[model samples]
Target: MTTNQAVSVAVADRRPLPHLLVFPFPAQGHLLPLLHLSTHLATRFAFSITVIITPKNLPLIQPFLSSSSQIHPLVLPLPPSSSLPSGAEHIRTLPDGTPSAALIHALSSLRPSILRWAKSQSNPPSALISDFFLGWCVNLAADLQISHVSFFSVSALLAAILHPLFLSLPPPSSTPVSVSPSLPSFPFPHLPSVFRRYVAGNPDWDFTRESFLSNSLSSAAIFDTFDFFDSHYLSHLRSSSYASGRLFAVGPIPPAVPESDNSNIFPYLDSCPPNSVVYICFGSQFTTEPALAAAISAGLESSGVRFVWAVGTAAPEEFNGKGKVVKGWVPQRAVLEHVAVAAFVTHCGWNSVLEGLVAGVLLLAWPMEADQFVNAKLLVEDAGVAVRICEGGPGKVPEAAELGRLIGEAVEEGSWPALRLKAAEMARKAKEAVAEGGSSFLAMEEMVKLLKQATTED
Candidate 1:
């Protein structure tokens, strides 16, 4: 062959590697799953990855990305706003009583800077993957002529319940609507309460509504739930034309750290009996009220169970002797996997729920905000892997006796053997879904294929 012919052949074989830009909401629950997804894509498919995070949250996730050369972190500055305290870019850092309007404004201010950075990339990202709330990124991607995918850190069941198709239901005029009696087949019985609280009068209702609606227009929607756990909701989403046939279940994605690396993070686990200790945590964004925290502490003390509780801003002094009280960040995934951890007392945040399920630990659900109530219902009422501590609604706190009784019952050997068995089974399924040739693994493969195809077409 001539020199020109050889040069042409070389050029055809040297296709540029596709780069994906991931932007997660600046909260622990949202950031972890999207980070894991980015790591998985880079490790499994050799895709170039760029993760955009605010300056405040950079330190927390920087350690996780240090070893991965394939993934790069980009820091975006939060715009100047009097509404947010100085240096408080992350949702977790905002004051406990910060108005939702101010928080939403702070988040929305991120758009211009993100768009500017996207345009400045040396090799422009082939696609954009962002948290569902950052729906503006979808429009940004369209303008950049790249594909956009929305990542829902919540469960698929919650996504289905919040979809536009369901929100169109007529509201009751006088009384709060009881969806269970009207729609018996509905998967989430707790949604009516969520509707009454969030959709009706919450300050962030507009933001939530816009995010879910915008998600339908994305190239694909990704969920952090395994198929075995949410197959019914996934199937319903796929069959519905409103979902755009781009729904993908690619998770139950745990942190990407090695087992050995995480083992020593919590040394206290070694002293407790195997499957005897209860692990308690509310996700980063939720703060426990003083009264409720005291009640929970009293209950745990009375229950006679060994526990490690990670309460974000709640004073550790309150529960110093009753049980371990961890303030600030803890290695949650590491703690959950410890052999001594028998059950979880959680706020029912989807990430915590997924981690608990993956570890085969039974759950004592204490949902606090947003989709947590719906998630609690799914776990306790539908899946049988958890027991509800009390009726969940905004500002509803259980008595210490009730909390203690539930904790005691959840840990009793003879009280709910079937629930324990079911939890173990679900954990097995979660593991299977992410293994080679499993549903979640294949979903990742399919996503990479689609990304490559989009790049080729471009």
Candidate 2:
């Protein structure tokens, strides 16, 4: 038997075999989690895997593929891009971008081509795994007679939060928004208007309309998160979906643990002269108010701590200077792992939180949109590793003093030997959650079985 077969046989002795094709939502935030999950499955289950990246992400993914020679063989074909719309090109900041309607049309046009490519493969992927944002994958799988599974790349807690919101959406509203303005805001005050629209609009309907084609198709759903962080909510999804047996929790799909001395992952740790630097980053989807962004810069400068800031196009001029804003896609994983990063001033994205906790860094939580406020609550109130900042309004920005104080407090708290010890302990737990026989690893096994059954049974 081939080496791949040998590995598959060993893994499938307790279940069945599946070949997985993973397609992520076309953005960096969506792609990273799905790619991590793909990497994990290929290693643990010896599954034949194909990771589909838009031309834009080719560079980022290329490094990982090159870094590990073993993962090279499982790489399968990329779908032909010709049939997709010009607008479908995964360009950064596309001008005059089409709305969901046009995006849906473009995906529909590309569907037939994706199917033809699937058929052309030597061993067709047994199961198709894609981001819930792409909704068209459900129909494409139907056309190809393959099992399609939707994977949410956010935290299970976020998924659970969205799930109830999805269920509450009224049927076929004209604008997809049924909620009133007076609805109590989530405790996290800094949510942006764009994301507020997302929550206000029935995301369930959004999922159905944009991703699942109004729920006409039956596709299994999976989440990319671990039970340790969100066991209660994940358990709820599991119990609810037990009858359908269509949901799986397989996540915390970070890079594989190193042989020993994982300290290398946090390169900046040694450079710190005890609580010296503040790290700033907002989620990709969040828009930075130029005023607030400048105020934050002044705050950091005034506080007199070295800072590493990650900002996008919306960053103000004042923040762009010596030892301040790194601006434009800083190596987030690497920076968080740095020892100099005393505190994380973050938008409280789930991935960022996971990485910070892994690096034993304390947090200044600044959630903007969706369940981020809720996540901040869990961290600040439950975990005691972070502090939550209050917002001015729906789209209002905070003053420099507010941001500075939060950063200073986080750095101070993180510098305490006891707090650092606690962070280290949390880091250890995070590592265990992904190790062999850990919750995430076992969840992956269960998900693989579900995929294989879905593939073969059909």
Candidate 3:
């Protein structure tokens, strides 16, 4: 080849990699999926990633950063605000009854610093991808003249229910409308129930709604859900006016948990019989109240089932001989994937639900707040992969006897053989979707292509 042609070829081959700035909502659930996405972008798409996090969540994400040279962690200062406690930068660290507005304001206050940092970057980020809660980033992306992508770490089912189509539905007679078993899917029943019971009472509900609306104005959205499970809801969102931009279902987004990292978390699992223990945990943000915790403790003991419970705080003395209590952060994905774990007693957080589904464990759905209740309904009533523990609203704590009965029923083959079979099938599909050339895999590729095209056009 001629010298001029060789020089041109080298220049074309050495094209600069796209830089993406990712900002998660600063909670464990939010941080995890985005972190996984960052890793995927780095390894799969060869993009440069800078994940922005606050001081408090730095520890949780530090290990991931240390492991990856391609992905960088940028720690931003938690803005000083009287609404939050001193050093309270994370949602999990914030005291109970703290207003959601306070957290939103605190997060919003960081915008100037974020913009300043962006301006100081040697090669400005080609795009800004943020958790849907950080709606301010959408505007910032516009100001920076780069592409914006909103990441919703939620199910498409939950998304459809929360969409304007359902939100605009007429109210039921009851103040907090109860979800009847016979409620039809068309026209979206039980939405008022969701609003009155979960959204209306939540201090930050309005803030969350506004954030979602703002995020809809972005270039596109990414959901941590798979096609087979969420195709119906995905179609609904695409047809509806709520989703303005392209919607991508590129998930069952499992975090990369190294086997060496959490080996010590569940040493007792070695002794337990295969698929014999029920693993229980709420997400990072939802602390099980004392009354419910006592009920669950009593229930687990009475059922005579081998169990591993991650209660966040110390387990009660009652559990000392009967079962294991994981006080600190256990490697949840690791625990779920363990051979000794038969079932998952969960709070129905999307991440936890996806993890349980991926692990092929039957769920004992005990929804705490927000979309969790809706998620539980989908799992139990619609999907048939799970059974509900608490039938009433969030206020109704499961009694010890009821909890025991449910626990026993979950493990009993005679009672739920069909359900168990279906759960196994769902797990298989979840795995397939994320496999090479699978539905989620293709969707992820499409998303990356769109991002690259947008960056090039900009």
lDDT, candidates in the order shown:
0.74, 0.60, 0.74
lDDT tens per residue, model 1, 1-458: 64344334545888445789888887767877888788877665666788888777887677568746668888878788776788877766678666444555466677777778877877778888988767767777887789989899987766666664335754545433333232213323345333433444444655555655677778888999988888877777777643367777888885675533422336667877787778888877766888777778888877877788887665555344435777766777778888888889888988889988998888888777667877887798778899877655556667888788788776677677988899999999999998889999888778778887877776
TM-score for each predicted model, relative to the true structure: 0.85, 0.76, 0.87
Candidate 3: clashing pairs of residues: none
* Residue-wise C-alpha lDDT for candidate 2, range 1-458, written one tens digit per residue: 76467575756785433567776655667767776676666665566676665454566576456543334322223343333344354523334433333333343445655667777876677777777666567767777777778777666555444444444534333343323242223432333222334433543325444453322244677776666666666666566562154566665567643212422324434555666777778866656677776777777766666676767755543333424444455667767776677778877777788878887787777776655676676677656777666543355667778666766666665354555666677778777877888876777777777776765775
Q: Give the number of the best model, judged by lDDT.
A: 3
> What lDDT score goes with residue 439 in model 1?
95
Look at candidate 1 and give me any clashing residue pairs: none
| Off by more than 4 A, model 1 | 1-15, 81-86, 96-105, 108-112, 165-208, 258-265, 313-322, 391-395
Number of the top-ranking candidate, with TM-score as the measure = 3
Ranking by TM-score: 3, 1, 2
Please identify which of the two predictions, 1 or 3, would achieve the higher TM-score against the true structure.
3
lDDT of residue 125 for candidate 3: 88
| Backbone atom clashes (below 3 Å) for every candidate | 0, 6, 0
